[model samples]
Target chain A: MQVTLKILRFDPEKDKKAHFKSYEIEADPLDRILDALNTVKWYKDGTLTFRRSCAHGVCGSDAMRINGRNRLACKELVGDIGKKITIEPMLGFRILKDLVVDMEPFFEKYRSIKPYLINYEDPPATERFQSAEDREIFDETTKCILCGACSGSCPPFWSNSEFIGPAAIVNAHRFIFDSRDQGSDERIAVLSQSEGVFRCRTVYNCTDACPREIPVTKAIEQIKRVMLYNR
Target chain B: MYRGQSGMWLWVFHRLTGVGILAFLFLHVADTYLVGLGPEYYNELVFLYKLWVFRLAEWLLVGAVLYHAINGIRVVLMDFWESGVERHTQLVFGTLGLFLLLWLPAGIFMLKDVKWFA
Candidate 1:
């Protein structure tokens, strides 16, 4: 079967207007969206530029807006989405080309929360062992691959753009809940500043668009409860 | 502002109305409670209500209330088990649009000179 791909194109040198360009490709129902994109890039359009680290869904480099919804191209199969699909760069970021968004701002927000383990005590030489219940607190959050899908799917991030979005918040939670980490007080203090967790209105759009199906809203609500009780 | 997405837009409106109603409630209670001074204070507040500025405030208040109430019901429905799982988006905008159409004229006239709480 053939599917029509309406990919958003922007050419700084030639075309000033950003427009949708269409390409038809033949593929079976089981084929992943990445396979279709590769077919178009190799045979149909030489100028098409996109990013992919692993052909599988692990690396998360192929995250983009597919049919106006955030997704990893490698993870979506054409059979599930149907015969026609529209592709665009991820939202809430600077579009560098066809499907690559400037993720520097995304990473900057990640770093603003200080996304590393901060413990007042020294590490034990042995592997850190904790009860399964303690690790369960942040187990879902740690599955995030720094994908911009959650941030891109958020509307506050769309208008305000400066609010540290769910991706970073989830990353922060992964460490914040860890028993070994003693920096939650500092991190919560920092997050309580302007344009922080309070900006989220609980739209749950980020929860909807996340490829990993991470309970982003739950994480946000958990952090919000922490922030509320701390002060 | 992205078009053609029903569920997402309802989510956006839910977010806006949720915040809007909270802020309105804070301001409204403060204003109403001011009348506790007595009839003169209540009458004076009503007199303030008679003017164009307070009238404008009342109008926006009416709008915010209507939007919040209508959208809040939508939220309640979405929270329910059966009906929300399928018709979440359709129920939200369909009800909101009907609410606007049914109440627009009455709301506009009721906003003027008419004592909202009085």
Candidate 2:
């Protein structure tokens, strides 16, 4: 079928502002949005740019707004979104080029949350043993791929860039809820601040936009409960 | 922003209702202060509320209050209860249902005297 992918294009070195450019390409109905984009870059316009590492959903590099929703380009099939699809860079981020956004701000927030597990005790000869029930406590948050989809979809994050986003809260939940981890107090101090989990208004956009189907808002809420008690 | 998703619409409604309620509160307080001016002035203000536009606005205000209050409870539940997170969408629709269930009947009874549209 013939699909017209209307792409938001920006060339900081050349163009003064971003604008939409449509590329009509023949694609199989079942092809992923990434495939259609590849066709655009290869056979249509060489300047058409987007990020794709694995060409699959796992990498999370090709996350962008497709048809007014945040999704992974590799995961969303053309058949699902109909013939004409509007493609743009993710919201709440600076666009570097076509379908490419500057993810530095997102990563900075992730780093601020201390996503890595923190344990100061001497290293155990064997891995720390955690009960099956304890491991299950944080299983949902571990599914996050740090794609920035959840963070970008958040309205609070959009309004105040300083607001620690849903993705950061999700990542924080991963470590905060872990039974074997010991950084809960430190993490709680960071999250309890005005710019932290309290800023989330439960808008649920983060949950809706997550490609991995992670309950981003739920994770944020859980963090809020923890912060409320710890405060 | 595009009005395509349930989350965005809920946020929009919540903000709209909150602002509307705030505006109504100021007007309500201002009118209540008319009681100090004397019964004559207060009765005159109350009589003005019997107008069709004011009556119709009262029904709409009731709906706004119902939605905002119910949705506020949902937000509070989601924040405090761990299980509330898992059932967020259900709670949103549930609150809307409760709002309509209350507002529809109350509106019918309240609109009897106004008969503006009728």
Candidate 3:
């Protein structure tokens, strides 16, 4: 069957505004949307551009709006999305080109929360040990791949870019709840501010948009609870 | 435009109802202040509310307030409850069900005296 892919295209060098460019390509229902995109870029138009690394949803690349939802092109099948598919760059970010947005601002929020584990203690022989029960507290948040789907789908982030998005909070939760990590206090303080967890109105868009199936709003709520009770 | 699901629709309704309630509050305060001026002025203004159009708006206002209050409880539950996230969809439907249950009867009572059908 032939599939029609309507791509939102933007050429910063020449075009003043972005526009849609549709391409009809032969494809199997089982084929990934990424395959159709590749066919468009390789055969129909060399000017078409997008980002994809692992092409397996692990790398967190190729996250875009597929039929009005944030999803990975590589993981989404043409059959699942139907014959007519509309693709656009993820929301709440600067669109650099076709299907690619500048991820620096998104990464900046991630860095603000100190994503890495912060522990300053004497080494425990070889490595830090933690029980299975302790690990289970934050197990759901560890699956995040920073795909920007959750943050992009969020309305608060869309209206106010200053808001620390769900992705950052999820990353913070991973370390904040870890028994081996000792940075919960600092992280909680940073998230308690006006631009932090309070900005989240529990819209649950982040929870719906997560490609990794992370319980994003739940993690953010947990962080709120930690801040409230710890004080 | 983002094509979000039930959660998004709930958020949209929550926001709109909140704003609508606030607006009604302002209008109500302004109208009630007419009571301080004189009974004649106040009753004259209040008499306009008996019209069919204002009666319809009153029903809408009641619906808005009921939905907003019920959904607010749902949000609070989601924040504090451990399994709230997992049961969010169910909670959304429950909120709607409860809103209709309360609002429908209130609508019947509020509009009973209005002779719209007659």
Could you tell me every candidate's TM-score relative to the true structure? 0.74, 0.91, 0.96
Chain A TM-scores for all candidates read 0.96, 0.97, 0.98
Name the best candidate (by TM-score). Answer: 3
Predicted candidate 2 versus true structure: per-residue lDDT over A121-218, tens digit per residue? 99899999999999998999999988898888878888898898888889999999998889988888888888988989887878888888887887
For candidate 1, chain B by itself scores a TM value of 0.62
Question: Residue by residue across A1-231, what tens digits does model 1's lDDT show?
Answer: 889998999876777766899999998889988888999999999898899988787787998888878889999999987889898888788778878789998899898778888876778899677899999889999889887888998888888877888898888888889987888877787677788887775566777877888988668767776776656
Recovered native contacts in candidate 1, as a fraction? 0.06
How many Å off is the CA of A105 in candidate 1? Answer: 0.7
Model 2 segments beyond 4 Å from truth? A14-16, B2-4, B29-48, B115-118
Error of 3 at B29 (Å): 2.2
TM-score of chain B of 3: 0.93
Candidates sorted by TM-score, descending order?
Answer: 3, 2, 1
Better model by lDDT: candidate 1 vs candidate 3: 3
Candidate 2 or 3, higher DockQ? 3
Q: Give the range where candidate 2 chain B is weakest over 10 consecutive residues by summed lDDT.
A: B1-10
Which is superior by DockQ, 1 or 2? 2
For this target, which candidate reaches the highest lDDT against the unseen true structure?
Answer: 3
* List of clashing residue pairs for candidate 2: none
